[model samples]
Target: MAFVGREQELAELAEALQRAAEGEMGRVVLAGSAGIGISSLLDELESRLADVPGIIVARGHATEPRSALPYAVLAEALGDALASLTDEPFKAVVGSAAHDLAALLPAISPRLDALGIGREAPALEAAEQIGSRVAESLRGTLE
Candidate 1:
């Protein structure tokens, strides 16, 4: 079901997408608390874009609590990028990022290891530093 109050927002998103299709770069930032429909809006936008030609969508979600794990979100977003790699050099660079992250956060490391990243050196940092770096990494990955 659609949120009854967000008709204008959806229309504006559609307009921005139309402009982007014509070679314009448009960005939207929705700032609000959880359950305020930001994710839903983003989901709607992505769903609308799915049928458009030449469109690629990469999404990352990092909550404050889960954001402490280094590169937790980047690794998720990069999975598709990593999968698209057939070349050795690009694969090495991106693969190393994935591997290093897995080793850094023990909770996530085993899961990533299951995905084939193995034997990586730990990314040593304090808890606060890890959180800060993870947020930074997420922002960088989005760009």
Candidate 2:
């Protein structure tokens, strides 16, 4: 189906992106009842942002055989983009919690290793437990 009018939605997203670029933080959730072409809208928005600088677009899609958690769908979608997230100028942005992140995302282990970090990265209390340190690590990386 052809991508039709959603100029207002697109503009809102664009404005949000601009605000983020100017160092304003915000969370975006595009949602509605099923079969409302959310995927196409996201694709279009992503395409529009393809050339925008200081922007890192990570997409999360919800599809069949979904998870029980309400946010799991989007989380699952964004999870796949984790590698890309870590691959960005991570070393440059990450701060004191480098080892914590190394534990969280092993893909970054080698980079951390080269920097002489995480040789003895602290062990998480549990794999399922994500402490505030890791969250701050990510905020720093994304900022």
Candidate 3:
């Protein structure tokens, strides 16, 4: 589909991608009423960045059915990307925090073990601690 207008939004996305390539964190948020081309803008961005090196893109949506799941949107978006990481790089990026993340994101568990991160079960009583660790690990991975 031809993406019409939104030149300014596309330019901002391009600039954010450039900064991210330069080792800086970049973020873009789209907000609008339904059917206003937010998804179209994202689709356009994805197409434009399809061949960009050293960047990973994942997409997810939240709906009423999955709203009860903690970090459901985040997990859906990042699970595959995180799972694709090889043992060495995964360990380098996630380090000791993999254990906690594994609890939250089971898709990454195999990679965690491949990195020699122990597979100890997180105690049920430690939900808060585990959540904090997972968030920190995710931040480190994105940086």
Candidate 4:
């Protein structure tokens, strides 16, 4: 069944995608209290994007226990996309960003090795800092 009462939200997402198509970068974050229909909204959003070429939708889940794990949600969501990077021309572009990702997602170490990049050492310090390298690497991967 179709969801109603979110035309405004859907329009905003559509506009963001249109800007992205025009080479403009936009970020959208949806947050709300639990059981407020966020998933329904995203399901509708994903359905709407299905007809658009060059669109990839990756969603991460954060359970109460898993939520505390750094980058765990990202690892889950991007597991397939990360695996795809081991092959093709993307291998050349990945370079050291492999280190950045491997720091957060250890399961990709084998994939990184396949790319000849080797495993990234644990990225956290005694203080457990991640900084911006992961974000940059994520952008590189998405681009």
Which candidate ranks first by TM-score, i.e. highest?
Answer: 3
- lDDT against the true structure, per candidate, is 0.56, 0.63, 0.71, 0.70
User: In each prediction, how many residue pairs overlap at the backbone (N, C-alpha, C within less than 3 A)?
Assistant: 0, 0, 0, 0
lDDT of 2 by residue, 1-143 (tens): 46678888888988888788788988677877788878788888877778866465666555565544434454444344444545345545555667655555556667666666544555578875555656665566555
The digit string of per-residue lDDT tens for model 3 on 114-139 reads 55788665565665786676677677
Where's the lowest-lDDT run of ten residues in candidate 1? 134-143
Model 3 spans with C-alpha error above 4 angstroms: 31-34, 65-67, 84-88, 114-116, 120-128
User: How far out, in Å, is residue 52 in model 1?
Assistant: 1.9
In the order shown, what is each candidate's alpha-carbon RMSD?
A: 6.5, 4.6, 3.2, 3.7
- In model 2, which regions exceed 4 Å deviation? 61-82, 85-88, 114-130
Provide the global lDDT of candidate 1 against the true structure.
0.56
TM-score of 2: 0.64
For 20-55, candidate 1 gives per-residue lDDT tens digits of 678766555456677888788778777777777655
